[model samples]
Target: MKLLFKSTLVLFTTALLSQAFAKTTICYKKDWNSPATIEVEKLEGGECKGELSYRDMLKNGWFLKDIKIEKGKDGLNYIYTLTDKRVVEIDNATILKNEYKKLDYRPFAIKILNVTDETATINVGNLRVGQSGIVQHYYEDNKTLIVSNAYVTSSNETASTLKFFPFTDLKQNAIPTSNRKPVTGDVIIMNYMYDSSLIIAPSQDAFSATREKYKDNNFLHSDLFAAKLKSEGIPTPPKEVIQEYAISQNLGTIFFIIDNTIYVVDSKTFAILDKDIISYNYIENKRMPFYTRVEKIEKNIFTSMLDYKSWFGFLNKIFGDDTRSEDERLLENEIAAGELTVKGEVYNNYYETMLGIKK
Candidate 1:
């Protein structure tokens, strides 16, 4: 009888320890910015106690602030504060024993689309199921994302388009003539020169064609002026005021007086195209003769002329000059002239006319 009683006591102790060793639920606070403390204890048979610091507790996402473990009449009572500012207490033991692993994967694909001289559009698609956020990709070598500012459209298709503004450094290399040898007839070469300064390469075909077209298009001439006024949105000034502004900007002086309005056409295109009234006002002081600034006036006059081949060739010439000093005055002058000519012509002619100004 004594042996049986001893055997029964041992068996009971073993069973209790086994139950106490079962998995305990780990609890943790999700807040990473703040720290919290944690405590662990055995509930059933043996008395096992442990305390976890906030930093260590973070690894398991469980933070216990004020913790206590005690054996009561009911069972093992584990009590703790979460430092979450809330007073809620968790009682599950299974949460402590579970192990977690992180999962990560590349969730999208990148597709390059048409790259124009000014812009590039790329398509990004196949986002992870149900995941939504700005898609980002890092260029490892550059240590930067190839592009950001990606916007997602709600077309139910998982695709997004990203427009990339090419870095300034890449612009030169991307030019069509970057790898080509210098050729006289090459449009790129012509563009290079034309872009530098208003060096008019008088190609017979281009010059005649441009001249003839403008002469026949009377509406186009008036449209140009009207467009400028519309774009400026300021009330039309008197003829004197208009002339002064144009001359100050080196655009050219007013020539023919049409119905109280002075008509000033870009010099290069003047003979070819009808005059565009740059300003309309009563004549004031005629200190500067209209022909005094004829060169500038002529340059301004034809600045709006569009010869794609010539323009491209001009750009190539400017960029191809490796021996030119960085601070060369001539180059600077050329660039300034080119900029003024191109912008003035395009703005005054095509764009303004498009906005509707009747000749």
Candidate 2:
């Protein structure tokens, strides 16, 4: 019975968010004969063996997307209306073991409206985390309906408002390729991979002057950069990394801004990545977090490998002998141990000198 319970839990959760967001799907699918809630369902013997349901229409969906219920248009109980092209068939989905109040759900329509890259007309909704434990679209009042969305922290998402988008998937055609620069006070926001950083310099000399300060203490606010990124706004940003940009071993690229325009610099030549998209913003004028893409920086394996020549030069450079410091002793002990295990010509030459192995 417990096993059956577990299976049912897995069955529902797999049917909901994960299964739905896996692709663009129909929440309520109708076959030739019947109106089936599941997009695809296969019954095995007596029980329902497999099924795909209305949640399939979610395209790159979020866990708290389109599921929140506000006070209805009729102004009575709380309700959330489905838009076009998708439906949410919420039969039973297992959630994390917690005590947060979950929503009561029923099968909605197959109204899958593409939400990403959409700029909503009215500044009504704000994507916020509610007590219900999901990303919910919150409006100012009950009358205002959330018709569409683009992600942003602020409520009023006008042209001036700072918004968020995936840095990697931006529309390439929209960025301007001109060499124009913003005035000294204009703000240019950047999303490097997922991390958000803002550059607030308008001139080349000022920006270069700021960039040179990183060598001192690596502080963004110290003489180098303008200011740190605060979730609230510019200049006084909280001391934290908004998102972590993963460093690649072999791939290197730098995304930097000049005159409110971003340029992708190739690591190899440190030149503009694409001439056409040089100094560009999003086609829709949206700004993404800019990551400085370093070009192919050298990582020569021969220079890094552990060998006699390398060991000799490196040890001599660092003065790894005297055995006074803990670091020096560790290196000497490691080298001595390495020599004892080998019977080769390389080991023979260094064993006497490094380990005091007398002839």
Best by lDDT: 1
The lDDT for every candidate, in the order shown, is: 0.27, 0.25
Write candidate 1's Cα lDDT for 152-188 as tens digits.
2111243433322111111121112111111211111
- Give all TM-scores, in the order shown: 0.14, 0.19
Poorly placed runs, candidate 2 (over 4 Å): 1-12, 16-136, 139-196, 199-242, 245-359
The number of the candidate with the highest TM-score is: 2
Model 2, span 1-359: residue lDDT tens: 33543453354345444443333211211122322322233322111223422232222231112221112223211111123322221111111122233221111111112222222122223211110001123235733222221222223222212222112222122221221212222222221222112232223333344345322212232122212222112221111122111112111233344333333322222222221112322122111111212122222334324444555563454454453355444543443332112122222233223212213
Report the lDDT of model 2 for residue 159.
Answer: 22
